[model samples]
Target: MSLEVKNLSLKIGAKKLLSDINFKLETNEVVAILGPNGAGKSTLFKVLSGEHRHYEGRVILEGKDLKSWKASDVAKLLGVLPQSSALAFPFSVSEVINLGRLPHSTGRVLDHQIITEAMSKADVSHLAGALYPSLSGGEKQRVQLARVLTQIWQKSDLGERYLLLDEPTSALDLPHQHQTLSLARDLAKEGAGVLAILHDLNLAAQYADRIILLSEGLCVAQGDVKTVLTPQQIESLYGIKVTVMSHPEHHYPLVIAS
Candidate 1:
């Protein structure tokens, strides 16, 4: 499956947040959305996930309009991991992960299988019976990722699963951050389109096949890391002087600053 956004714009009250946004996500591609704080990155994620409806342009999935797809249908096709997900009541990690099966048919066997697979992929299988509220920040993030993985992991139609992650590693430690991104890259390698909104420039450069730089409600740059992470562009977008260097192993652009 693919995602295409054309001339997209959004506003709230009297402020325009995103303007004329245009991008396409191809199958097996990992695209990172990078921007400064309050640059409408979250809003764009909402639009992509179909959580926000009112917009000026189109969000097309596989050539069909996003709005035309039913909520259940969309849930099966795409899984969204937001910056923060909270549960009012204390639910067991297993219970939380099982919630991902809501979009599927009611069957205990299938639910158990999906939850088990998701937990294994997220490396949270040992914490399955623990209370969600009692877990550490990184643990909770991993549990949430398991939930999303369960939601989209259908063996028969696996190629259509699209993972939308917004700052998935914000609350995680260094190890967990790499773990989460590595899982995302693996998913993309398996023919899933993974779109992530990330703040860590180095992580984005290392994992993302392409980067989309948004600044002041516009997509200022979109391409490989070297072309998109230039010193001038970094300074212009975030008011920071960044030095770009090539990674010794991967040869990808690496960002550093004084």
Candidate 2:
């Protein structure tokens, strides 16, 4: 699904969280929202996911205004993984993943095949029986990913499937972070629009097809990593001095603090 944010602005009391932001996303594209702490990246994700309202602007999904779509209708087309999502009740991994199917299933033959496929894709099949609360941070993240994956896989053929993730790798170790993001890239390649908010510049450069850099509630730079991730822009956005170099094999931008 193509997502277009037009002149988006958000405010809370005395603070402007997002200002005049605009971007367009194409199907099967992986886009990264990158910024330092307090850069409004998460707020942008919330706005895109319809979790936050009372904002001025239009979120268009496949050329239709997002505000006009029903919540369930939107959920069927887009899946979101926020920074921290906790299940109060102790639902098992399988049960949690099954919740993703709620939008499609009407008590018919539950598609266990799809569920299993999602679990395997997320590397959480072993945790299918474990209580969600009992799992570690990374495990829980994977379970949540599995849930979103199941949602997308079930309804992908209906419309453009979009995966919106906010700091999905924050709680994961290095290896798991790579694993999860690689899986996300694979999904994007299979025709899902993946938008992820990431703090790690290296990961963003490695995985994102395009990078949008936000600073002080505005989009400061955006494009391919080589163009958008220059040392000067990085320093201006984060207020930290850094060097941008070429990766040895892939030749994409690589960052190092000066």
Candidate 3:
């Protein structure tokens, strides 16, 4: 199963936010979207998550039109963690995570078990009773991740689940940044499709099976790490000199600014 976007474009009264975007996000792989600022990365993510509708082209989810699926059904098979959350409510961490289970009719007992597992995965078990607003930015980010994890926790008969994360590591510390993407990689190994919008090229290189590069509302290139992240391409995209070499301890490319 796959999520495919073809000839996708969007506009806000002809401003042309995105133009002719095409890509396939498939099961059991982690795909990363890398780009400079104002490259329409977030707008493209909004489209995939069903937050934007006035656009051209198609988003096929598991061989069916994404718009055709019921909101609840979509919730069960796709989980989204956006760039930020503005929630000021004093909900406890566990309560916030429990909201992810709202789309299902699963019994309370099973739901509790799922919530616990999600919290554990996110490393927020000790903060279960803490108020969400009382936590630091990174802590809250992890809680939100746990919530989305609860939403798509199981591989239901509905189909393989897909995850969309918009700058999921923005508020995280150094270790947790790697931790978050590592968890994403692990999920792909367990049979889910994962996509992330990232500014850190090295992080994408380390974790993504493939990379999609965007610039000014269009795709610049898409391919495996070494094929797409040449030094020439990086300098052209960001207007800076750089070096691209293989990581000494790993297989993916390593990028250094010059």
Scored by TM-score, the top model is 3
Better of 2 and 3 by TM-score: 3
TM-score of each prediction: 0.96, 0.96, 0.98
Give the range where candidate 2 is weakest over 10 consecutive residues by summed lDDT: 102-111
State in Å the error of residue 194, model 2.
0.7
Clashing pairs in 3: none
After superposing candidate 1 on the true structure, give the runs of residues whose Cα lies further than 4 Å from its correct spot.
155-159
Ranking by lDDT: 3, 1, 2
lDDT of 3 by residue, 1-258 (tens): 899999999999859989999999999999999999999999999999999988999999998899999888899999999998888999999999999999999999999999998898899999999999999999999999999999999997888899999999999999989989999999999999999999999999999999999999999999988899999989999999998888888878999998
lDDT of 2 by residue, 57-121 (tens): 89999789999987878888999999888787989999999988887764535568878899998
TM-score of 2: 0.96
Summarize candidate 1's per-residue lDDT along 34-134 as a digit string, tens digits. 99998889999999988789999999887788998878788888899998887968899999999888988859997898799889989899998899999
lDDT of each: 0.90, 0.89, 0.94
* TM-score between model 3 and native: 0.98
Which is the leading candidate under lDDT? 3
Off by over 4 Å in 2: 106-110, 155-158
In candidate 1, which residue pairs clash? none
Arranged by TM-score with the best first, the candidates are: 3, 2, 1
Q: Candidate 2: global Cα-lDDT?
A: 0.89
lDDT of 3: 0.94
